[model samples]
Target: MPSTEITDDTFIRRYADDIAYVAQQPPATDLATLAAQLDTVAPRYEAAGITGHEDLETASLHLDEALRATGTDRDAFLRRAHNLLRPLVADMTQEYRLAAGD
Candidate 1:
């Protein structure tokens, strides 16, 4: 079966739990997963006319590098990923709320 197109709302729904988990307590595995997830949806975000698509793409790239460098400090990588993703998630959440008239 073909997958449905990714919309901002759908993206949020897909990642909300993961986002929350990362926000509260991010592990290396979860950060990797979130990075992969972000990379997957970056093109969708651009196609959906979302702002900050470039920033998301850039962040995802950084995360990819972070994941690759095994000797790097895990805590530092987590912080970097968290900092990069936090505002993106906030913007997406606000966009969703406004679209839904909440």
Candidate 2:
């Protein structure tokens, strides 16, 4: 959670936006790109010191499940991923926005 201040450069904002954007698209629209983006989350999370954030962990589980599925299975998982992650992303974005004084 944010306190009174946070930098706009924080990694979670971009990561949240990217995940939201990808999740909103039709699953088959770009599975390869989605997978590529999901692959970056771990290293980025480690760099961002995002451990113990429940929202992030939940969102990551959804993304990871989607990453491991294929074809129609992947599509199903992606749809659920969007549903599961949307609120987590929104909460994170709102915290960052408030901290940034937006």
Kindly list the per-residue Cα lDDT of model 2 for residues 1-102, writing each as its tens digit.
833222113323434464434234332234344444544443444454444245454545655666677776765655555555445555544444454466
Clashing pairs for model 2 are: none
Best by lDDT: 1
- Model 1's lDDT to the true fold? 0.54
C-alpha lDDT values of all predictions:
0.54, 0.46
Clash totals in order: 0, 0
Q: Each prediction's TM-score against the native?
A: 0.52, 0.43
Task: Compose the digit string of candidate 1's lDDT tens values, residues 1-102.
Answer: 953443333434545554443233342244466566666556655665667666666766766666666554543444465556667866764564464465
- lDDT accuracy of residue 34 in candidate 1: 59
